[model samples]
Target: MGRGTGPSMGLMNDLGSKACEAWLSEHGEGLPWGQVVAHPCPNGWELRHVADAGRDAAGLQALPPGALREWADTADDGLFRPLKSAPTLRRGWRCLVSSHDDLELALGGVYPGGLGDWWAVRTGQGGPTSFREFMGRQTGVYRGVRGLADEAARAVVRACCHAGSCIKDRRWAVEGMVDGEPGGHGSIPCLEPCALVLEAARTMARMASAERTSVALSGEDLAVLRAALERASALRPPPGTREAELSAPDNPRRMKLLLEWLGPEWARPAASPQE
Candidate 1:
């Protein structure tokens, strides 16, 4: 049977136990998304859970850069971003400044953006400072950066990272396999990709801080985008090759990608037994 595109709400018990479904919906936040404990209802909704998603160790793969936004879609829907109240970036966040283990950055500073949201950094005590203020003080690039309340900003950041961008060593860094690495299924992270992702995220945040929508692409949508990036990468200009001939051949959107203005994300690995 077919299922609803997203969370199935306001339905009755004939399809499944009202109380149980309600329990999962209410209590399943923040828990790693668990499996469907019960059989799916005729309505085609599976009773998914959230707990120890990391249990799938071999299943773990570094989240792709551009893909971060998609992952957050799972959070806002109340599936993974289990918040005390509604999921909002304005809740509370703490930044552990190494020395300040108990630094509570703000009353609200974290967003369980979703599957790929960086839970590690959000784990402990933060300070009363705004996330942007904290970030701005630390670096020149973030000097003018502000506002993490925008869902779209978060998405743009995630997608850029999935494409292979991240801030590492306290600076925007890109991780990827230029061509490919040993275990590198595709692009590895590096500095350029990180810069690209940050630029995109900032632009998106500035343009639409108020926009809100669940944007994790459907499996099919991700697959298509991935393929498109890969195909474009093939025509990228080789190093030191200054001639236009060194540039990507005439192709749609190929130039931007080949230029590494966008990075490629690593693919997810198969599930292994949890440690």
Candidate 2:
């Protein structure tokens, strides 16, 4: 939208900028925040509650100056999750989505952690509604950046579309494809939406290589494909993200086998955690 940040949003940006400046002053400018922090922006910054309306301007004006980090720097190019949680929603400091894109478009987090499993939901008739359907009606920033690049990415988005319809809407077939498949866990049949998305991506990359050239992804073509798929990957909320979290296999057996893939501050398991 506009490049304006309302009174509240303006204040958050001020604090986030200040926090970044403070961090860089200590941390140095050689490295980037995305490389340093896994869950960057709106999460791992310093913030003090500013209750006084009078003191805010001074805070904004007094911000330490330098070539500060931008939202794109921390943006995983829509890798894990694109939506950032608003700090006002939580009692913490949040980073700016970008100076160019209105601060109003940075709705990244659904709920902060320390509250328990951020993905828990009610079962039975009162189960969670379709996240995309729910979010479509809202004015959150997540709605601002939706959609993917190619048919495969579209497949991932469609499969990950949060419609509990998969639970019942069996348009695919009577096969177990609707149900989640195994990754490492010996779950039921069918492809897990997350695994399906990843697999679809790999398949697409392979096809892209074969169709375009026998060489690997490079230059602008690689960049474009990566952005599209990553954005698609980021669009799915935490509930959908659960599908990807599993470590099962990516075999699309016994099911239709057509590939497909955040919420809260969903914590990811380490690459190699101690057993």
Candidate 3:
């Protein structure tokens, strides 16, 4: 796909360039100091928004003055307008897939499979009809293998350490094996999706370490984890599982198990405290 040539092109380019730099400094080199700014670019905000914002933001103040106007004038309206539409989702997906390929070229193919590849397969097979459908179809795959790995990894970490806390609390855990490295050793906590889990684990681990208590993976917790694994394993295309089944039930067994694993001190009553 061609780049949008709208008046916002220069502004977008400038923003993209800054974003790339920020991403690289933070993620690539582990820099300790850098300022990164992000603003929502809603569909209604046209080239003027980009130009105006660029002028206002300190980081973008250095941008060539005429670049924004020139970009707007030369940019193709048809290309620029469609980019503001919902179709941009697919376009963004494709860009991600391509970027992965580029990374593989430079970094020796670290990722085993591209998300776009899996998405393509799911969409082509007539799985879920939309992005929502795609998420439902694939979340199971993540929960099953990746989820199990995460659970097992945490369990093992707790078992081996003095903390006795679930690994989920100590570090971020990821679903896929990197470069065939097993037992989730190479996983980093900063990446997306898994990052949230890693943060939770880190918090738990810190708490356990501070309290001088070990994480206890009781039989009930294991059962709950296993059930989650089972649900993940049983997942199929959207139509395969009724929407009603996806909704959380009141007093879910999983919730009870999780609370139990956290211990009574951590558990709270379902209702809020009175004022």
Please give, for residues 247-274, the per-residue lDDT of candidate 2 as tens digits.
Answer: 2222221011132421111232335757
Error of 3 at 174 (Å): 10
Q: Give the TM-score comparing model 1 with the true structure, all chains together.
A: 0.21
Order by TM-score, highest first: 1, 3, 2
Mind giving the per-residue lDDT tens digits that candidate 3 earns over 1-275? 01122222333344333333333333332221111112323321111121233453333323222332222221132222111111111100000111222222211121122222223333353121321122234443233222233444343223221111111111223333233222222111111223223333333333333445466776567556556643542332133332112123221222332342454344232356478
**Which whole-number lDDT from 0 to 100 does residue 7 have in model 2?**
29
CA-lDDT, candidates in order: 0.30, 0.28, 0.27
Q: In lDDT terms, how accurate is model 2? A: 0.28
How do the predictions measure up, each by TM-score?
0.21, 0.19, 0.20
Residue 69 C-alpha lDDT in model 2: 23
Q: For residues 90-125, could you state the per-residue lDDT of candidate 1 as single tens digits?
A: 111111111111011110122122111222223322
Give candidate 2 regions above 4 Å deviation: 1-151, 165-200, 203-242, 245-247, 250-275
Cα displacement (angstroms), candidate 1, residue 199, comes to 2.4
